[model samples]
Target: MTQATAPCCDANPDPRTLRGCCIGLSVATCLLFSGATTAADSFWSTIQLHGFAAQSVIKTSDNRFFGDSPDTSFDSTEIGVNASVRLDPKVLVAGQVLARRAGDMYDGTPSLDYALTDIALIASPERILGIRLGRVKNPLGLYNETRDVPFTRPGIFLPQVIYYDKVRNIVLSSDGAAVYGSLYNDLGEFSVTLVGGWPVLDDNVQWTYLGGDFPGTLRPNGSVWTGSLWYATVTEQLRFGLSGALASLRYAPHQNDILGPGQTDIVYGIASLQYSARRFTLSAEYGLEPVRWRRYGPLLPRQKVTSEGYYLQGTYRIRSNLELMACYEEGVADSDDRDGSEFAGVTGGLVPAHAMFSKIATVGLRWDPTPNLMLRAQYQWNQGTLVLSQLENPDFPRQREYWTLLALQVAFRF
Candidate 1:
């Protein structure tokens, strides 16, 4: 997944960095293979290596998304390599590196997506418990943990209302620790995960929260706390999940800065459900976000608001290797100002009311010609620009209230 909250550097990546990452991945792969062949029964045999690469072409009838879409763009691509080694029966080490390019949001920087040590506390047929240390993916909604892997995604793009790409860095991954446990029984299975860590903060976070980059610096005020609980039926036909997060940040002022030191707190929660039959799957998720800002001098007063988002999606397997999908999603930046009238009024009409919310309807097709390859095409009708990021579309005033997008992608995994 893209960094959910952190705003890093320029969107255009350095050529040196891209080359280094590719060379590093090649070296790592060779070393792993060499060790495996050197000692089949040794530690090498416990190693697992996997990777995936995907490229997408996107076009839009109006409003820019994932590049200059009106002119047709190929700015969306993802590549990742991961490896795991079992050091002992109860211990394992795993890591992954990812390079992603998403229009002006990301610059194909090769970054360590995750590097963790997993220690099993308990292992049995009925129950299991474990702890992960190091940078780990924040287990948010159903798709967040695995969003970076195209093969694992149900569609070319996730429901942006919930798995938003604009502020993805804010909740993408964390550095710290996590505890997970699972219980299995005839009736159903229960599972839970708790995470305490600091999110990767960057300029993008500033863009998402503060609107733009300030002269001063912004950093995590403290650890972010996230948790999730899930339950599934015996046959796994029905599943439910509840997840939430508490995140905070602080900003320091520079001399002569327009703003003073301030703090921002976000409280978010979501409920997810999915039901699967032999050929079709139905899924839905709803999320609420309450945000608070305080002590930002006279220009920015203490304020709070709750935003809401939800989506309903379904997919039908047309054949052994093909599927059809459709989804509808909506998001409101402020439930109290769902139409943005109040917000726009407060801004003295500088911002349009339509900017406060977004709605999207989509239809898509997925085909698997080979076990490791996937082809997808999707069409989206959208209303509102609430989901578009300022970094990608700097000319906010020129944004359209309604737009349509078409996307096609090819992916391969091993």
Candidate 2:
């Protein structure tokens, strides 16, 4: 997905830090190339800068309410910046920043929270390998990297079922590196990459409630390594692609609430397929994570959480500037317990841990009134299962859960 096809953005059009960084690099790269600036550096002898902004309004409804009301509201605004400099004809560098509101994401916080979003470099495609680093976004699935941009995506909201981790875990980056290349083969053009690294940002940690004492804190502490292989080719008016990965996440011992000193073994796999033509494009993906969470705490439960998810979607370009899109997703998680009840409803009444499921369906339209502007509107239906504590529950502690939401966003690119 590309940001150009999404919706809603205005005000705070760019972040000052990223702007300064890229501009600084442009000047440095120019000085390194020659003693001074060159004519080739410009769109006419300089740097090119541009960006987009967006705002979203979300409404929610719960079928069965345990607390609060049956309806709620949230708003999110985002600012994106893209700057590029031509060090020379054969060498160039580029950077991007994405800052969005805290809105519905962080319940305890207000006033949009921001961070260093994405940083990458483009090189000659013919090289044996291309590399990129620095708080790099993880491209685990087909649309994870480009879904935020309207021009690259069919709809405003990507399948939340798949992007759930990315939305909440903003530290979705690798502090390592990746080497990639394209090879010509009989099957098609093969894109191969070998990547590995650790979490780039370690400023945030998640917490879970037990009672007066806070335990069961899920800390993002670890190092990950993975490799990928993909293939895509063009035939007539149609194009198709497929990708796969084998990765490992090892968490070193760290002390916390529920988890005193622990680690989690993660083996995740991903696959995707896509086909396209002038009128429409279709794509789908499936992902699985086999996890074994271990801890050395009397209150923490030794468990293995298996997570799996998939989605199917399509977009049809009705005309030169208008398009319609839709998608459906199903996600599931199964946790296995060794004891009778690791957690129960009451005090000392071993709590029973069970399996959980989630599903979502979304449909929307994107209006490209002009090449640089997009308008989007979408409706989503979601449902999930939850467990509440006996008395002063565990967190929100509701046995079962369900929700209906209406989301609208507008996106633009320059």
lDDT agreement with native, every candidate? 0.82, 0.49
What TM-score does model 1 achieve against the real structure? 0.91
Instruction: State the lDDT of candidate 1 residue by residue for 1-414, as single tens digits.
Output: 010112334432233233333433444455446545645575767889999999999999977788889899899999999998865667667888899998877878778787777778999989999998777788888889888899888899999889888787668877778999999999799999999877776666677787666677777899898899999998899999999999998989989988789999998899999999999999999999998988878866788878899999999999979999999999998898888888778777667777788999999999999999999999999998788876676555677899999999999999
Q: Which numbered prediction scores highest in TM-score against the true structure?
A: 1
Query: Tell me, what's the RMSD of every candidate?
Result: 5.0, 8.3
Model 2 lDDT per residue over 235-295, tens place? 4233333333333322333344443565445556677777777888887877675666566
Regions of candidate 1 where Cα sits further than 4 Å from its true position: 1-42
lDDT of 1: 0.82
Worst 10 residues of 2 by lDDT: 1-10
TM-score of each candidate?
0.91, 0.71
